[model samples]
Target: MGKPKGRKVARHGGNPNAWREPKASSPSLSSVTTAEGLLEKLQSYMESCEFVVAEKFANRALERFPANSRVLEAAAECFTETGNITKARTCYLKAISVSPLKGWRKYLGLAQLLEGQNAVLQYTRGIEVMERELAEVAGPAQVETPNVPSASSSTEKDTAEIPTARDISNAYLSISELYTTDLCDDDNAEEMCKYALDKAMMADPKNPEAFQQMANFFLIKGDKEAAAQYVKGGLTLWYTDHLPPEQRISPENQQKVGVDYEEGSGMPGLALQIDTAKALIECAEYDLANRLFTEFITHSPTDPELWYLNGFSYFLHGNDYYPQARSALTKAKKFATTPHGICYDIIAQCDEHLESIAKVLPPTEDSDNEEEVVQTEDSVNRPEQSNCEDSDWETDEEGCEDVEM
Candidate 1:
């Protein structure tokens, strides 16, 4: 009777052990103890474009790890995305102050927020830091791996934060851009830009950005042929077979085309492709540009800029492609007006192109009327001439009389 009074267990219809209370999972964001954990969570939010959530998480991380350079940098990225430039600048400055020589990215981040000489200065400093850091780990044989530290004793310093080759190359590319733009009037602008580009190529010979930058430099110098060559070089890095006929790599040569790029480096592939296509258009490679722009349109159907570019490419091609150009520009105009609601200059340009096309390609009815009018005018104003047969007969009779005499 006492045994019967023991607690009873409920069972499902099939297996009694089939389901049990789910075990507590790993800690959530609220329970994240380490700065690294918080930074990871923050990055996840940022990647998802959840800027508000990222900003809040970043603020929390800053409070938890006030002196952590990475945490500060992460917070700064959050602020920058959320349009809080003041706080972003402050965080970047603090991060630099905390560990001035350790992170080159912080300097670049701050540089992006500034302009003109100030931006140039920051970019230069960032490049210097990157060079120094890279030199430390230049040779694998010279470097020694440290023992893995226990979790409790590990710090951010124990983490490997080495900059990749592409990072250094892109840094130089940024300096090259600054020299071409904000510092264009400086005495050594062209020379500095060339130097930076050379360093970029040396740092990463396979970098598309370096090639594209060189192309841009040549284009600015009005050397279109050189620009086109560099554009081909850049495009070859990613789209070897998709390039124009003159630039496509043969099967045998494809093996020689070695790209030294990480999985995700510099700009997105689509953007780089777009840039190369633009360069192609600039270099009068209209057919190839149109092909790339068409593919891009399929991927980004509603992108007004892409449509405009496709239209521009067709428009520049020749009179035969006017119709296709008209269709693309019309779509671009519609997208720009309804959704984008800006790019008035682009809209104007589209209108101008449409007008030019209309002038060149008149309506069928009007052209038919013009043709009829021309035919009628030609028939009404037909020219008259003397009969050569009568002149020949008179001349022949005179010659016969002279012979008889």
Candidate 2:
């Protein structure tokens, strides 16, 4: 039979394009040549958690821009994140050598890589550089009349790379933490910590980390109320102050508020936010922690660690929150099991929590009602009810006789 005029003949029984191979897309890194371009590419890879690819690209960047301080610093950051501590140290050293007195960040980076006195010395150098740089920049303004506003101050606000008081404060905060951790055995550790913390707050009263560090210090001293107050102070800087009363009431609403703040401010990155959330959790601020975790989960739904943290926060809130804890833990276990084999540890922890919840909650009314219904049906069908009654009577009589004896 002849085909109809409007009918189209099938090519390979369906589509002609089906047999064609897909074209591979070129990598964006191919176009990058300048130091800035390479840094951006390196950062994009690092942010996406592509450490292997980031390492390869970082090495390529180093080969191309061997003496570029910015490139070296950025590559060092990538290496540090990927656990190549030795290479990261080398990169930081090279970066400092290339621009010794210009940037303070490389000193801080190298300091973080070292331990004990060496780390303290590096941190001190970085702090000195920061102070000197700030004073030099502010020198011209000090020379002018006290009432006059500096032209540079207005212009500097738009520059993201310029170190500010907050940076100096954060450096001091780092020193304070080191005293509490790596240098705790020193006779002057507590005094040094307090001094550093005081410097941090004085340098930048608005710096949230200063408040957080103070909270930690107070917590170490076993002053929970003071720690909580400081934690609240930290939260006020970037979180609570930005929200309306209505939005502050619930975690979901608070998460929305956080998202809006993040979009507008762009100051607190995910890591900082996570750190703040963890601080809240540690200070027994479960509501705030849960809200922050909700926002984090919205941004990175596949992050099992966040899910686990959320669950743990609820668990610590007490038995009343067990249901929410179970749900979050289950989600955490599910995500931890994917693309990799099931995480037996997560499974075990989740099972343990579930057992705890089971122990706390009474048996469901439905089960009890079902049992009663089944028993009633069995009694109706069985003609041996009298025999059961007789057994009960005999047991009661035996008990009575024993009591009398």
Candidate 3:
């Protein structure tokens, strides 16, 4: 080789733990001439969370190559890690000054460090920086300089000046959340939300973030129709609409066909399905929830909590699923461990479900529901909304109102 690379020359004494050495005095600025050597040291310090050491390496690099925007960017990260946000802000500004047309990333970081009107201002500046950078990269006369690598060359995440659609979506979502959720400025928040949706649609026609934000925004404004429209726009439509009876699982007839999952049992697929089903129930997608619950119960039939939720969701869907609802509630009551009002509620629900079926069902269908009526009539004839000992309802699980109904 004509010349050796940036490897260290043999010192008088070499230690086995050279790479593992603790933070020490800064290297001489002239000694670390090449950006690669400085970057390697800085990256090592950063990976080890030695922010001060990383800053020292970056400063040394900057002293030799003042125009090295990447070194300045590295220094900014180190400053941020050391909790010196003001210094970090200065470093970012220097990075942008060094290469105005290639500093969108630094601008993005600078924006994150600000808040309120300042953050909005910074974000607006960052958008302009990114647009300018993209225009420069796409210009006809653009030239590649091999002498100095771009800051983005440090990693794939920082490689692009043109912001990805997801990136734009995230920026919009952040600003919207800041205005709507943090500041509680509904008017400005709504404007931001609309702009975000437009940006998201421009980025990708089917972006989920746009739909989710629209759904939440409309839901907050009490516009259910608009909420429903946006909810349907999302890629996942499982929670959007009602499922016909045929879509629900007949768990009683599912003859040990699937696997059962445990609560935090560490079984991967089962937990995922159960969690998905549980979320569906919360979103009032009882049809899909019922199917997931039934499938999970088939595998893990002994779970009293699952039984309870199955019964509860069916009850909410009305008397069409009354038989299954009553049966599940009765089963849940038997399996329940706590001798609390939850038991009473389940029993009461069973009674109400039976009464409802008696009205609409044929005379022969009345026998099963009426028979259950006499069995619990003497002991727990309290209505579904029990007037006695309301304290029992107070301690129940999620969605259980603490009021004495």
Using alpha carbons, what is the TM-score of model 2? 0.59
On TM-score, the leading prediction is: 1
Instruction: List ranges where model 3 is wrong by over 4 Å.
Output: 1-33, 44-67, 135-162, 236-283, 288-405
What stretches of model 1 exceed 4 Å from their correct place?
1-33, 48-60, 140-154, 242-267, 301-304, 330-347, 364-405
**Comparing 2 and 3 on TM-score, the stronger one:** 2
lDDT of 3 by residue, 279-343 (tens): 44545667766876787687668565677678777877777777677677656645432323344
Q: Tens digit of lDDT per residue, candidate 1, span 1-405?
A: 011122335653554334444237422446676887888888988998988767777887888788888889889989999999999999999988877767788999999999877887887888877776677778746644444322222365556377888888888888888898888999999999999999999989989889988998998898989999998877776665454455555764455332223456443466677887898888887887787778778767977688888988899898999888877877765554431123345556777887898899764664345435534543443323323343321222122111100
Q: Rank the candidates by lDDT, best first.
A: 1, 2, 3
lDDT of 3 at 106: 76
* Winning model by lDDT: 1
The 10 consecutive residues of candidate 1 with the worst lDDT sum are 396-405
TM-score of 1: 0.66
Estimate TM-scores for all models.
Answer: 0.66, 0.59, 0.51
